[model samples]
Target: MAGKRRKVPHALHSELSEYSSLLRALSTNDTLDVAKRLTESKPRKRKKRTEEESDGAAENEGTAAPSKKRRKRTEDAPVDAESTQNEAAGSSQLPEEEPNGDKPKRVRKRDGWTRWPLLVTDLRVPEFGLDEEIEALVRHCLRNNNPHPTDEDGDSDPEDDAPAWLPHLTQSSSAFLSSLFALLAHHTPARPQVMQDRLNAIDWRMVLDILATCGSVDADVINTVKTRMEAIYGPYDGPAPTRLEARAVAKSRTDAALDEADDAMFVAVRPSKRLPKRVLEDVDSDALDD
Candidate 1:
């Protein structure tokens, strides 16, 4: 089943609101606003001679300390661009703003396991505990540094490296597995597979058969996942292959070994005959005490 495609959204509704507010603030800073900002600094320097010169001098550090500080702040803090001028303006008239020396509060995730850092703990399950190395693989997925389709040098570019995190905060430690292999461990054991491997693993005829009977998932979601799987890896060639099992055999393994031992040998006396002529294996005549 083919899923109806929709255009991708660059940002979410919640993010758009914040971005809109920031844009309004930025857009308002026009030629006159720039002129006012430039002219405003010099007056502040002269204002140091005022009655409150000692206190005012601190505000007159940078030619325009507030704007400079705000730009510097972007490295460590979320620029509250909506609170554009008045917040970081650093002017004495604006009530000397306190320095935000602290780093920006990171956006934590609801699942308790964060995606931003892509920790193995995010995928934690009981089959495997939190492994720190999974974070690197998650990072590799998030890296958008893949070469452009048109680039002649695309083939030459080596893999990229970078970090991004949106950590889940609500994860329980012992309750669940923190590993990707947890789900399919018994059979399919999900992990990175090249396209050809994916093709081999999947049995498309079985997919259609199961899809007809699968009632748990919405048809749309099933289509979406199926389409995504097909797009990433070519379709499977055959239906699921049969898995052969060993025939049942009695008296195997531990019980068999124990039953074979002379001291622990299993003896069966028939009810009809009561006891056989030789009730058990004949004892070694020479070894037995006379």
Candidate 2:
């Protein structure tokens, strides 16, 4: 009975072979279906193979000899698109740093000249006594009507007829006058326009008095101050008296006095050659008595 069991093909043998083939075909089809499903998925899962597993697989496949284990490429790893774009936008919007490291500085403007205050100390007269002399001269010139008195014949005024109160400046006084004039000549246009403007804004009489008192020792100095004052006050050609014109008048009077003195000296030293015979006779008579 055991020998027959081994030799005789049972009716179930064909069915069993068919079942085995079908099972193999089904496994292959199932494997193919799994692969297709994986490809069609929206999000794909990457296969994670260990280094040893990959190397062993490659050896079994008869490919090139396995190399050293490679480090994963994290630098180029896939990132969320929205997150990456948000990061980039945030970095771009950051404010830049200033190279100077601080806020910018500001500049201020200067005030005009008229803003400066005057002090009482600046009003004191100089120690040279020039202020008194200049004041006297100015007063005399303004008050005295006849600086030079003419004879009835309209001839040159006699030496005695000259004004009594004419300004007779000393050598020191003359030097001061020259210096004042020089100062005026040099600084008339050089002084800042603002200073002139300030001067003009003040009362003319007060300004003139201040200048005259401050610069009395020298004519030149006085003139310089006057020139500055005039420039501010607009050319002072009006009936109002000016230092420049006063200086000129004073100079003329001085020259005339000098000329008269010279004439008197000449007359005293050199008697007239054409004197009358009677006058000569009287002189000879007196000489004989001496």
Candidate 3:
């Protein structure tokens, strides 16, 4: 049964080696493991001879021995005595065996690159944990943005101009973390969009994109995060803003919120005390109209 099991043949190994050479030029790291295993040109172990095969080989050896004329010619030629002795010793040497009679184990030698970065899993990080942890990380890293700046400022803004992550945004102090949570939210039961809008807002936020922005990730290490997420989610293309264009989106939302508030019993509504010059001009104009 062991004799019947074929070792990995050189022809296949050679073909895989060529294939790997081509694959090396390619950017994706996905097929590299299979390519490495396929090209492994491990030394083939000697097959244990069956009794029938051994008997046939013995018969062939007897028939295939050199003829008398060739033997006489070889004997007439002066052989180097040292070379003859070394060849005889090498031919006669027995295969190695342990003290207990076990054959030595084969240690696989492999290229250093082939060792692995080979983790691929379907496990989705929970949305709550990603949001909370990244939010915490942002809060922890921040020096000036604690206590949060509201629409109204206290004696000063908290040493930083903005408490928000992206210009004037919602939640999470790191734009990278916020984008991650937003990307994940689309897959969950909540099914909400990536909720953010600010100055010069462009909505394209892959994991690499955000990391690259903050100088955390190298620009050269191209994103493979989408390769995994897209595999699970089908197509990941879903789900941005500007201040003039943003004002259009905000005006509709603001009007809707006011309408909703108007229908409810009013608690209180007052003008904001710390309106900036731009807002104060708009407020003065509104007061004259009123």
Q: Which has the greatest lDDT?
A: 2
In order of listing, the candidates' clash counts read 19, 9, 0
Computed on alpha carbons, the lDDT of every model, listed in order, comes to: 0.42, 0.51, 0.48
Q: Candidate 2 lDDT, tens digit per residue, 45-118?
A: 55665667756665644333212211232245656788778867986898854333332245476333332232
TM-score of each: 0.17, 0.19, 0.18
Candidate 3: 10-residue stretch with minimal lDDT:
195-204
Instruction: Estimate the TM-score for candidate 1.
Output: 0.17
lDDT tens string, model 3, 97-192?
323323345679832322112123212234565445554455456635445745556565544543545342324345665554455433222222
- Tens digits of per-residue lDDT for model 1 on 1-290? 99998855767766776676554444333312434543453333322133355345554653467578767878777756665566546453665444331223455763211112223322324454343335444545544555344455455443332222323321332123432123223223243444322212223344433433423224455456656757644674432211101111222455666757855455664677566475687779888967
Full-model lDDT, candidate 1: 0.42
If ranked by TM-score, best first, what sequence of candidates would result?
Answer: 2, 3, 1
Q: Could you report the Cα RMSD, in angstroms, for every candidate shown?
A: 27.0, 47.2, 24.4
Query: For residue 104, what is the lDDT in candidate 1?
Result: 39
Model 3's alpha-carbon lDDT is: 0.48
